[model samples]
Target: MKIQYFIPAMIYSLAFALQASANHPGSNLDDVMSEKETFFQAINEPDAPSFELINAQGELKKLADYEDKIVVLNFIFSNCAGVCPLHSARIADIQEKINSTPMKRLVQFISITTDPGNDVGSTLEEYGQTHGLDPINWEFLTKKADDPEDFTRKLAMEYGVKFQPEEAGQQMHGVVTFIIDRGSRFAAKFHGLKFKPINLILYVNGLSHQEKKQKQSFLVRWWEVIYYYFIH
Candidate 1:
């Protein structure tokens, strides 16, 4: 075949292969949707719960502030010596991958402290630095003074997470990472420290461009079938 000669199936197959090589984006197909469901619990509520807090730099940060970008939300305490560190590392890993993709600018990473009392000021900043979180698009936040102190702790509760103080100022809490869409709607959650970071990254990649009609399409991976039937 001449290089100038091309067919619809060939072009579609090439484009689909390129996309598959990168991050798998939004899919309306039941199998893909079901796979996402098996990995992250969906919370497509009318409105996601909101919060008001300050980042490590003392800048005001809120849920509404990121209404235009997909938000990856997590909970951690500066003093945590167990799963929290692992959780932050997981986020860092996910961040590195997201940074390598176009979705990096389309996403915001937020870590809310469950122990706001000790996770403030330079302490939070140092924690992020130690974990290699770039401050450009990432923030380590806690409750501001005169904000009831327990503001973030209770906020975690609203996200269905709980934290109990332990010896040496550490905390015992559930490990979960949440995803919120551009419209401020809670999308899904990658629970525990074991969920693949790539899954969340791909999930965010999908949500970053997902639309109503795309989510209602007959098959999101129809090109796979196309290539299989036409080329194979």
Candidate 2:
């Protein structure tokens, strides 16, 4: 896939700081390294939660259903007249730039509704249609209304997204996106305000290439031959 690249200010800022502090301790660079390392750990960790959600078609789908592909997931309610629309539009812009990749192979986008009570299957369908989402790959989902609280909590904890509900159906939450690699690892997190689809694709493509190389190491090749040569 032809990956789109867009370097944002924050990336250059953090990277420069980390580069300066790579080998020095008890220096200003150390603090920058610590912060960058913390961010890296948060993104590169192996655990990515998979949950059941009702898709726009009213069918059950799991995050695992899209295994072996780069997945971008975000949480937003259809009723959200605030940040949700802008975030979705930003994602659409990114998709347009990376139009060469196959929808199923290179990327999949999912939006999970925090306001499950109102964002039903039909509602999600309407929302996707309203946003001009490419139904071939993009999906809007709502958790079952019966005790959506548990699912909501699971989603928040799994993706490290914070969703706070308020009276009159208003929510105070950050616009966050999670990128899951082909191996289903939490590869990156994009704060809503800082989320740029091209940047996400570039970083995820880097991770995908890295994982592919790691799988082809000599140790992996030897183990694979030992484990499967006799059977096949």
Candidate 3:
């Protein structure tokens, strides 16, 4: 149900051939391999996903905005009276821990709605307040929940999240929280109930360092200059 930004395998193969012809031996292969590896790691990494859907101030959000920040993503539907509250409480504990540490700016948390139709902006706001979540640090997002589906399904599938509607609203069998590193790749995953605050902090800190090094790489510098030159 998710639309992906990645090009199809055939397209990648064609592009690889063309790039290979235009570049040095194995240069294209290296580039293609690196790109493929990043994608592979994103999905193959335990409990990690490539993207998430968020509603920031009543609008949709993509993964790019938090590219430089350590991101925590999870799925929760507001109306659930069961496991969701406990899940949120655990997340709250993690947030409180992160808020007390120096990793604040380097970290961001996103909780997406599994039942987007009923979980509108106002509902999300109230839920945030009820849980003592800081709006700036925590984002509760939703989208239209028509039969055709919307951003919710796209994002959920992209991240491999699973949720099903129930009597009151919906229930989620997926209890995992995705940990996305700086490259927008999933770095780790934790269960909603058993995830540790300290471990998350350590993982995020390690990712921050990795992201810093990747940015400082020679290729990234060259791309930055080229990007600015064309865009500016």
Give candidate 2 misplaced runs (Cα > 4 Å): 1-42, 102-104, 210-232
Give one digit per residue, the lDDT tens place, for model 2 in 52-166.
Answer: 7787677888878887667878888877868989888877666554444423246788888888778875787888777867776788877764654647646875677677778
RMSD of each: 7.5, 12.8, 14.9
Residues 1-232 of candidate 3: C-alpha lDDT, one tens digit per residue: 1222121222223222221111112222234223322222222243244443446365656678787677887778788877888788778877876666455676798888777777876888899888877877889977633334455656676676667655655564567677776646566456556543544443343344322333225333433343344322
lDDT for 156 in candidate 3 is 72
Error of 2 at 161 (Å): 1.8
C-alpha lDDT score of every prediction, in listed order: 0.70, 0.59, 0.57
Model 3: worst 10 consecutive residues (lDDT sum): 18-27
| Candidate with best TM-score | 1
Please give the TM-score that candidate 1 achieves against the real structure: 0.78
Query: With candidate 1 superimposed using the best TM-score fit, by how many Å does residue 156's alpha carbon deviate from the native?
Result: 0.2
Q: Could you tally the backbone clashes for each prediction?
A: 0, 1, 1
TM-scores across all candidates?
A: 0.78, 0.68, 0.64
User: Model 3 — TM-score against the truth?
Assistant: 0.64
**Candidate 2, 207: how far from true, in Å?**
3.1
Q: What residue pairs clash in candidate 1, if any at all?
A: none
Give candidate 1 regions above 4 Å deviation: 1-33, 210-232
Q: Residue-wise lDDT of candidate 1 within 165-227, one digit each (tens)?
A: 778887778988988877688777778976656456545645554344543242344434533
